[model samples]
Target: MTDDKSTIGQLPDFDTLANSLIEEGVLTVAPSELHGMLSGQLAAGARFDPDTLLRVVAELMDLDILNGENIKLILLELYQTTLAQLQSTEFSLQLLMPDDVHQLEQRADALGGWCSGFLSGFGLYAARHAKLSEEVTETLHDLAQIAQIAAESEAAGDEDEADLMEVYEYVRMAALLVFTECNPEPDDTDEKQPLLH
Candidate 1:
């Protein structure tokens, strides 16, 4: 067996300017910064700004890397996505529905499952450990509020889809972070085996 002192990843700095943009994305943040970040994600002819861009489009494949508990990393991705949406003129954020809300909720639940397993697997002392239950409990309530607004909008048959993906992305990222925390390794080799389960 390997020694119990392995350092997997950094405790991400939430101060990342990118996260600020995404968290602010659901709301209005400093727009110039977002404009620049979005420009960086685009190909040639994109007009945002070179100084503040962020691009690693290749992430979608290994994206399964995020499970549920790497809150900070997820936040970073959320920040980047926020920039992308803000940069897209064709995008709209005011036309969400019950279906979208339900899907987001499912995503949240999946994250919770991963978190539970992670905490169980890590014994609460590993670097990836997260008190996901609390963070998720709090976040879910606020998300419900957003869902209500969306359901009402849907009832009225409106189609704004305004900034919904931003919120959804946050939940998704949060899930990924939690998954990361709970699942420090891709294989089950280092996982602590329980005598009872």
Candidate 2:
């Protein structure tokens, strides 16, 4: 198995994944939202298995099986890259979204979609847990609100751009917070021992 840290700096970028999806005619979910859904599942302690991940994506996105192989490769890479970023000690998580060249409203819309996907995936698994910490509960509530955000009717000015970045940063950190809380690292010293004769 590859070390999670080894995969840290090698994540596939948003445009590349997005373009590939478009070329393949899979338009059901944006790359950002797909990444968010995977992140949410990982945060909720879902095990990493390529087939299972592909199945979940298909079900969630209403994807057709005939187009599965190529999409499966993309999804697997995304899953590994996301899992690695989450497990890294350096706090290197990055949300998948378009570059700054894109208009603020478009990016904001993607961010909202990402939050929606995260909530969907998180809610699907988080229900198994009897309770969540107060912090996590509040964070989920905040994410839900973010998911509903719509950009202003007027042209976005500098202030709107700055505000959008602030919201983006909050959502990024919120994802990390959820992951950290739900998937605490196991203690090395707590490893199980073999039974003695």
Candidate 3:
């Protein structure tokens, strides 16, 4: 756990990961979407070894040329940092998205993409498990609705900004909820409990 906490400090920023993917001509997924996908996987108990990690990234990015060392490094860092955040007791998970410099619509689009990616990743594993609680199902439904969100008007105003911030916080907490539900901590008996059955 301490090691995982230390690794959080090495997490790269959104722009750095986005730029690296852009440099490699990998635009199939945005940085926010990628982070969401990784979080979903971790929450659903999808542990990745090195080969599995590379394969999953290549598949998600639709990349045939994944041999680039720089891209690999950036992706590995993202994976480690995301897993650490999900496992931490501090509730430190952060969604990757455009900063305030970007237009409201652009940020909203990224959020939609992130939710879409999360559903895809989580479904890949959760489908096999079955029997999710009603709360989890409702959360999934909410996230699906949020995936369709867009800027309602052309000119964004202060009220719109406030609404977006509220939505962002909702999404952040939602991810943590899913993670906690899927990966409960071990008890003193040391028996691993089944998740969400």
Candidate 4:
């Protein structure tokens, strides 16, 4: 857990990592999108071991670009951290996304991709295995709608910035809600105390 947390905190620059994946011809989706997919799957109860996780990520990205040992290790650690974070008692939606310095249109595009990936991941299990509540269904619908958003370079005004911020927060909260609904906290059952011998 510590390793996972530390790695997450000290992650390499998003652009650098993304460029590496692109250079390797392996990154089909943006970093945020990839992480969203992984998180959605885990939250929906997909149990994948480290190797399996790596394989799935590679497939999602379109190839096994982890030809290098360091990349492989880093990705594995990220997967572990993501899984742990999803299952955490202090679970929160902390997307490994690009910084806010990017333009509004670019951010919107990235968000759309992330939403698309999230829906894909959630549907993987929710469609077949689990029974979704009405709320979850609605959330999924909302996300599906969001996935269709396109880049709109209107202006660099405060209102637009504020709206973008709101959207970002909405996505974050909506994801956390979905995760909570899918992975409910364990009920406290302590009717009988442990016997002290």
Candidate 5:
């Protein structure tokens, strides 16, 4: 457990940005969902290439949303924050999501979108598809199940709150485990610096 928290404090409001994106007809997936996808890729050992990520996001948006300076800056901050947090040695990663002010059902649905984005990002990585490790396979399956979460019209009671909390924790811990499993820390002893004559 790292003492570090996400640079979320320094970023713009999540729901505001998401709404802006929606109004602009930029993307179907929200910013939090997009972050989920990026985090998944980083966990799989992808480099923190902001340009490439922006390009991927633009592709996903169907139209370039970079024309707006605020949007561009927000995205840059998001990528930077996610990279910093996930790269922490203490497995300190948190999902970028709407605040608790939102309804539980809405939050759960957003999480489902986040999971769907995560699976999409995983699919983009050839390594994920090529391997057959049982643990990783099972993790992927679990994520897939969450991705299909549907919203309910009825108000959630105490049980739903408990279930949502469990799911949230599971998703958070699952991401950490997947990241650790895929990208083990490099052994310092294996490095051999070249001797200068």
Candidate 6:
């Protein structure tokens, strides 16, 4: 558990984004919200949801929290509380680890590729409501790579496979959210409106 906390903390923030999501060509993400989601303290119900969390993130980006570091005290507080809450759960999510790093990496890579394709629809889908920002689209691609690498099932001794699975679940959920956003389906009765660009 100590190792999991430390490992999670050590993961780097997506700070290399130079241009805003507007520059990314597709605008599915707000750079700031992603920063908070990816970097800052994990909040309750923080799992990526297109209309909810990502939208909040976009607002955060427009508000400039995306660029400013919010990990100083906020993330720490959230982490501790969230950790405690998670630990208190009756049953926790479990991850299974592969015996070999090479095998695990192979699996992660394949998963990542699929995830990347799924995420691409958010910006490119014909019905996606928002035009993807160039920076956010590129960043999400970068995220797909990081998520793939992070999905490696084998890690240093004492690292739990279950932890990795949990992390991967988060990654998958985020990717799916982006995909759905890009390719949203309209109501059965509502008039057709095209948001896809």
Over 4 Å off in model 2, which ranges? 1-7, 66-70, 150-154, 187-197
Q: Which candidate order results from sorting by lDDT in descending order?
A: 3, 2, 5, 4, 6, 1
lDDT by candidate, in order shown: 0.32, 0.76, 0.77, 0.67, 0.68, 0.37
Give one digit per residue, the lDDT tens place, for model 5 in 113-175: 777777776666635445646887788789888867633333677888788878877887777
CA shift of 54, model 4, Å:
0.9
TM-score of each: 0.25, 0.84, 0.85, 0.80, 0.79, 0.31
Candidate 1: stretches off by over 4 Å: 1-137, 140-149, 155-159, 189-197
User: Where in model 6 is the C-alpha error above 4 Å?
Assistant: 1-102, 120-129, 132-142, 145-160, 183-185, 189-197
Question: lDDT tens digits, residues 1-197, model 3?
Answer: 33455446545777888888888888778888888898787777676766668778787789865777877877777887787777778878877888899888888888887888888889877864567778888998999899876423345788888977888888878888887787767465323222331
lDDT of 2: 0.76
lDDT of 6 by residue, 1-197 (tens): 34455322322222333233344332544222333343221211123322333334434344433333443233333334333333322323111122244344444543443344334323233232345556546646666665556545444333444554555676544444343334334346232222221
TM-score of 1: 0.25
TM-score of 4: 0.80
- All candidates in order of TM-score, best leading: 3, 2, 4, 5, 6, 1
For residue 21, give model 1's deviation from the true position in Å.
Answer: 39
Number of backbone collisions per candidate, in order? Answer: 22, 0, 0, 0, 0, 17
lDDT of 1 by residue, 37-119 (tens): 22222211122221121222112112323232333344444444443343334332111112343444443333233223222
TM-score of 6: 0.31
| Candidate 3 wrong stretches, greater than 4 Å | 1-7, 151-155, 186-197
Judging by TM-score against the true structure, name the best candidate: 3
Worst 10 residues of 2 by lDDT: 188-197
Candidate 4: where are CA atoms >4 Å away? Answer: 1-12, 150-155, 186-197
